[model samples]
Target: MKKVKQFGETVEGYNIPVLNEREIRASAGILYLLMFWSWILVIFKDSYLLLKYANMIFLAEFIIRIFISPRYSPFLVLGRLIVSNQTPEYVGAAQKKFAWAIGLVLSATIFLLLVVLNSDSFINFFVCHTCMIFLFFESSFGICFGCKFYSMFYKEKAHYCPGEICDIKAKQAIQKTSTLQRTVVIVFFAFVIMTVILFNDGFGAKPTSLWLIVKSAFSK
Candidate 1:
């Protein structure tokens, strides 16, 4: 975290280190891709066990973030961009606010459509490929669709504004893992878990494993 003086107040003690953007993007991008693959396994591969267990992990992580460490929201990254040293030339107070609105709406629309349409393919496409492609391009070439969209919508308003939150020296970025690395690891792990569930001799005995087994076992 970095400290900076703000308008009419001595703001201090609020600073977040510059993490490796490459890694952070990669990590998030991979997780998003994994979500799609997990969905595929659930629908086409009949890998219920894998999906169930993976969801548990997700739930646990969500609990930790939402309940335990509420301040670790990745969206803060955008907020940081507003005040950090790495503030983009085009971003400013108004642009950041605009970006927040647009980004939220875009994301909500995506989620809503996916749910209402039961969009297996579209969800898979986004989780498995879209996010990765976008993040990869951003990390490697500094291309960002979110950034571009914000620019287009707020170009005139933010043309001369430098959206630096404060005159603070913040860290660079946070990097997770690379796309290739995440894909290989996540897919392999999912496959293994599915295989175990499918092959387990008594998988049907459990409440959630092979539904067929539970159905027949109960019939008798």
Candidate 2:
């Protein structure tokens, strides 16, 4: 029973239980895309059907992660399959459990408000976006936003972070960003603002169908 209920794998050379960070990121990416698509449908189509389903699924998955086992979580299993060919990057399971507890709370809140209660409000919007941001950072940058709070709540320091971020180490030469890079990023945003200002009207105009234009030209 203990074996079946274990939270993480006890791999050799690791003092504590650990999980595959690669699979975690892959799972985060999958959830992020799912929630983003449902959000788009909500915004454009005024449909809550997909969003509600997403919330239910999200809630169930997190419940499994926290209560049952990460190994049995459907999305995690899928993520493992997707990244099976790649090398596994092991990270401490304790911080991940804490992080996923936050996820469970957020998902449950969303399910309650949007699904069970059948309501909408700023709270729902805020929480949904918060989840998206968490998932986005985890998947895209290998950063765990929720894991950042582990140290605050617990006495012990987090171990084996995705990028060894828990350790205090100087940045490598290759990892350092130069002043020119910062300047270029700032200039790029400035250029983007100018572009929007100049092209607002043109960009807002509805596009014409190419087939319609071709047909009209041939007819003429």
Candidate 3:
């Protein structure tokens, strides 16, 4: 059982030094979704406190993860609890550490620009959007953009990536799908789009401005 340690796993011949890919990705998924909504609040209400303090807390967690240990990270603890029943999907911890290092740097930058300097400017916007992209890819797609730097900066390749994306390409067997199945999937979404676009008038009345924009776009 390897003493049920929270950081890293020994798989095959590789010695990982951090959380498995699944738990980390799941944690990132939760974190990014919350951050995204917080950003939306920033957009509408001009709320910087939520975004600023959240970035600082995010950087602190990554510092614990990268320097102290993943076991001590509160976010990773929540991540583990979230995916307690899922099977482990192991990957190289060194690469993930590299990724989190980038995360720490980005978070620190956001903290400095938004929190300390009070710079409500486009540079802050650009950095925030970039972080969103990184988080979105990792959380939504299980793709680590910063981990891609592992091979370029180091000698070894990251293994057991979420989709085996690091492996060399192999020919895949083709399977034919019926046109009826495709039609069903397409029709389902088409129905949903029409329902929202055609029937929904003002989108809950309070957020009428957003709905007005959508209505105007569709009208044009």
Candidate 4:
């Protein structure tokens, strides 16, 4: 019973329970793609079918992760297989649990609003996007945005963050951003805005079918 109910694994050389950061990130990526696709369907097709199903899946997955062992979660199990070749990067489970608790609440709210209540509102818009942002950071940047709040809620500092972000240390040379790099990024954005302003009409023009164009050219 204890094994089935356990939250994290007790690995060798670790005093506290830990989980594979790689698998967690992989799982986040999977969820993010699912949610993003549902959002696109909602926007382009004006359909809530996919989003409804997505909310149900998201809520159920989080429930399993929090209540049962994460080892049993389907998404995490898939994630484990996807990243099986990579070396495991273990992170403290305590902070992750706190962060995922927030996820559970968000997923539950979305499920209730869209699936159960059969309603739509700005609250749904805001919460859905917020969940995506969290998933995006976790999957893309290895940043756990929700874990940032763990220290605020608890007295003890979070340990073993994804990138050792919890420990205060000097930035490595490679991690430092140069002034030139920052200026280059700003200049690139400026160039992009200028191009958009100059070519808005051309860019917005509808594209013709290549086959139709070819047939017309041959006939002419």
RMSD of each: 14.4, 3.0, 7.4, 2.8
Q: Which 10-residue window of candidate 3 scores lowest in summed lDDT? A: 1-10
Candidate 3 regions exceeding 4 Å error are: 1-7, 11-18, 174-220
Better of 1 and 3 by lDDT: 3
TM-score of each candidate? 0.34, 0.94, 0.74, 0.94
Over 86-127, each residue of candidate 3 has an lDDT whose tens digit, in order, gives: 987777777788888888988888888888888888888888
lDDT of 1 at 70: 18
lDDT of each: 0.45, 0.96, 0.79, 0.94
C-alpha lDDT of residue 142 in model 2: 99
Candidate 3, residue 108: Cα displacement in angstroms equals 0.9
The candidate that wins on lDDT is 2
Backbone clashes in model 2, listed as residue pairs:
none
Model 1 RMSD vs true structure: 14.4
Query: Any runs in candidate 4 off by more than 4 Å, and if so which?
Result: 208-220
Q: lDDT by residue for model 4 over 1-220, one digit each (tens)?
A: 9989988899999888999999999999999999999999999999999999999999999999999879999999999999999999999999999999999999999888888899999999999999999999999999998889999999998878899999999999999999999999999999999999999998999988999999999999
Tell me the spans in candidate 2 whose CA falls farther than 4 Å from its real position: 207-220
lDDT pick, better of 2 and 3: 2
Question: Model 2, poorest ten-residue lDDT window?
Answer: 107-116
Per-residue alpha-carbon lDDT of candidate 2 for residues 1-220, written as tens digits (9 for 90 to 100): 9987999999999999999999999999999999999999999999989999999999999999999999999999999999999999999999999999999999999989989999999999999999999999999999998889999999999999999999999999999999999999999999999999999998999989999989999998
Please provide the root mean square deviation of candidate 2 (C-alpha atoms, Å).
3.0
